[model samples]
Target: MDKIKVIITDLDGTLLNKEHQISDYSKKIFKELYDRNYLIIVATGRHHLDAMPLVAGFDFPIYLVTSNGARIHNPNKELLFSFDIESDAIKSVLDLEIDPEFTTVLFKEDVWQTNKTNEKLNKFQKELNYRPEVVNFKNETDLKAIKMFFTHESHGKLIELRDKILVNHDHLFSHAFSLPYCLEFMDKSVDKSVAISKILEIENVRFDNAVSFGDGYNDEKMLTATAHGYIMGNAPESLKKKLPQLQIIDTNEFDGVAKFLAASFLDADVLKN
Candidate 1:
């Protein structure tokens, strides 16, 4: 009900449609809001190298919270803030013994690394693209892991692995399913809401006055941090069931976020028949 001071959204399932690109309408809406002096920030479970290019066309100041808030970069691409797993914790996760069905992915320093090439990866494009660095994890050491990941098809199986890993290591790291096929591990303190609040504080804005949108378990804190939070219709059933109180927007494929923004701030009845 308070005048919205900032617009923050998650990438993949919230802003980007099924084709993994921001719709023209979405871009236009954000541009209009930008012209009105609203700060637009994108918070994603993606690495900066993987997330930054998608919003490069914004042509305005936009902050990026990457690796599920393990790191943040300003519009100028400067490292605004960062949090990494301690060396010991990184070692423990690296030594994790588990099913080979899951592929490993991680971000270290300025690079995105993987044990092998997996075609299912959304960012794996054949054109001039940001490719993952393929290196056998066995040969890598002393890695200051910003975030580590495992991708597979079975959400239930991933939960099993997640719980098993957390049995002893939960204190060292936090885990979340960015996508049904992807489970991510970051430093225990890493959170998108925390990172967003830091940005808001620097911008001298109120947390309760922020407007946020997201569609995953990783986004729970982010959605709860603001008085206005929306969940995408395409979110996992479990996520919806977990937070049924959050308003449900249309599917991303239909530009749900854009429509909501237009209706809310622009005084447009996009969702009205």
Candidate 2:
């Protein structure tokens, strides 16, 4: 019930519905929050280029913390902050034997590159889009990788890989499960909470004045850093069980974030659809 000066949320499973699209009801709720002068921030493991389109139509400023906190962009889409995995670290991972079945995607400044194409990923996106350039990492020399995404059908396999990487290469990068099928890797120092804190500082705000929502292992820090944080009902059981202290809200399929905003901040009820 504390006053909230900023609202931060993850993309794939928090603000976005099950289909990875924003619902009209949520749009209405966000618009009202903007009208009421509530600050908004979108924190995701997505690249800045990929995230830009999803939040663009808001018609209000929404700061972005992308690449699992490796990059930050202002509402105007100006690059405010950025960090990259050291090229040596990039080469080290690229050298490690990864499962051939995994689809590997790389991110840099305005560059989204992948080793292969997987149409199956479309189901998890707002668009059935193949937006990354297919490339062979072995031949690349000059590269700035902010984050690496590895996807597989088995979330459990990805979890195994995450553990393996952390155990063998813990000093090289941080790892997380951004989605059931997606494993994310970034510089060891990258963190969504740290990124959000930077934004809060720029705005002259404090953690206690912000509320955040997320549904991934990558979100743990940001959720704990904020004064109020909630996890979606649809979030993986592991995450829910791991962070029982945070409240669990309705699933994204049911407009969970919007419903919460309506109850906590708006006068009108969000009638169930």
Best by lDDT: 2
Model 2, C-alpha of 223: deviation from truth (Å): 0.8
Candidate 2 deviant stretches above 4 angstroms = 123-130, 269-273
Cα error of candidate 1 at position 203, Å: 0.9
* Candidate 1 wrong stretches, greater than 4 Å: 122-129, 269-273
Across 15-77, the per-residue lDDT of candidate 1 in tens digits comes to 998878887888888888898888898999987777777887676779999889988898788
lDDT, model 2: 0.84
TM agreement with the true structure for every prediction: 0.93, 0.93
Q: Write the per-residue lDDT of candidate 2 for residues 105-183, one digit (tens) a residue.
A: 8886765778887777645556423266788888888656888889999988887877867776798788888888888
How displaced is residue 93 in candidate 1, in Å? 2.0
Full-model lDDT for every candidate: 0.83, 0.84
In model 2, what is the error at residue 237, expressed in angstroms?
0.4
